[model samples]
Target: MRRSVRSPYTIDLGQLHFSLQYNNWPIGYVESTNDNITIHSGENAIQFFGELQSISSESYNALSTVIQNFLTGQTSKIEVLAGPNATSYPLLAAGIVGLSLNVHMPPFSEQLIASLIFKSMSLIPSTNTRNVMLSASITIKINSPLGQQSPLNIQMMNMSVFLLYENDSVGMLSVYQAPVKQL
Candidate 1:
């Protein structure tokens, strides 16, 4: 299924430019398509933005929702496959590149959750540390007949910001702020 996520005021670490448009991600199918023939694509997509420290998928909707949502949306597309007498739909992804990085994620402690906000940043220069204002968050919905919803805790004990860097792109080592509040 197709899911939607909205990101407001995304930062461009390269040119230090702020994208004028708010980020919208239709990630999971919210109300329709209860099956799993899925596909999705995006530009400047924020699904997994930085070096993935930790990742997991609780539950997901069907494949058709992914295809239809992507086909009808601007950030994504759906492809139709035709054979002798059959038709198939799939989500299009140009290519896949894996990233590897070494990061220190300190365990969360009472001292850590003591506050309501935590901050984090990618490897950046000392000069740029003061300039790192980028942030990311997620909103999740639980699938059930009652239609319950809640934001899942994707953050670890350590409040680390997930930042993406292009191949050959490099930033300096700096301190980041990522605040977290216990629910």
Candidate 2:
């Protein structure tokens, strides 16, 4: 007689870390909506909502200048990076769609809380899996007192949800496996 054997399988999820930079230097802490990322195959696209908090006054001023320029029809560029790949994209204030800035008064430790919404600027499909990574760099240029240019950069990194193509048999199987909901 022979005994049957069973093996367990595990899936490893991917993670992404995002931050803002100026001249290659990191700025304040960046926070996003969800801490854990999980993409369902059913989603066509995903949007990231986040806030940059506790930034220095100088950094805040620089960012404000960038936004001012963007609102005036000037294009700001943003740099995005993932692993070994990096790309730059132009951001228009009009494209931002929604924005809110809150400044703290003195004696309370000055801080700036900025709400930002970023849409799907572009997409890159993964060659190995159904996953995709979206990366871009945003550049903001401001004029100095002497009429020189000062540039501030914001970097973004995010991953797309797993693709569930309608023609994919595996995706169909997973869909059927989901528990039915009774109304």
Candidate 3:
């Protein structure tokens, strides 16, 4: 006879909350994966995938601004705080160090249907905060096409920030307005 076992770790997206400008956008679904084999090479990683339906243009605009700021080497970050925690983690430490985004936009629609994909790695020798900071590279994909043209693809790199975790949820925080540089 053979013995079988099941992993005890799991995440419920329903309990997860993601926000921009204090406005919470309802997430339709979330999917995540962990790669244990990569651990041997010192690259143990987990990937999160999700979709947000019926997002307003205003909300999407806010998201676009944040992405643009980070990509331009400006001081930009996204705050993430998991369940019941008052502390929100700021992604991208200082001077663009730990994150990336890929955006996809669909063509011809009354409202914008966007797909965002974020990817990043865990920070080595973690931080001392109550939350854990991950070295992450995120990709936001917008599925909207451009007037009979193909969809748009944008990539941003090097965002350093902390990721707070509580039970099984996560959150992100960043500057809502563009920061003015002082000389």
- Estimated TM-score for each candidate: 0.17, 0.28, 0.25
Model 2 lDDT per residue over 43-111, tens place: 322234434432677666655654554445454343222221111211322333233222221121112
Model 3 lDDT tens row, 8-111: 44422222222223134322333333222112222224344454343677657655655455444444333332433111222312223222222232223323
User: Number of the top candidate by TM-score?
Assistant: 2
**Candidate 1, after superposition: displacement of residue 120 in Å?**
15
Candidate 1, residues 17-101: lDDT per residue as tens digits? Answer: 0111111221221112222222233223222211111121311232333433433432323222221212121211111111112
TM-score of candidate 1 against the unseen true structure: 0.17
> What is the model-wide C-alpha lDDT for candidate 3?
0.36
Each candidate: how many clashes? Answer: 32, 10, 43
**In terms of TM-score, which candidate is stronger, 1 or 3?**
3
Candidate 3 has a TM-score of 0.25
Name model 2 segments beyond 4 Å from true. 1-17, 25-32, 40-44, 80-183
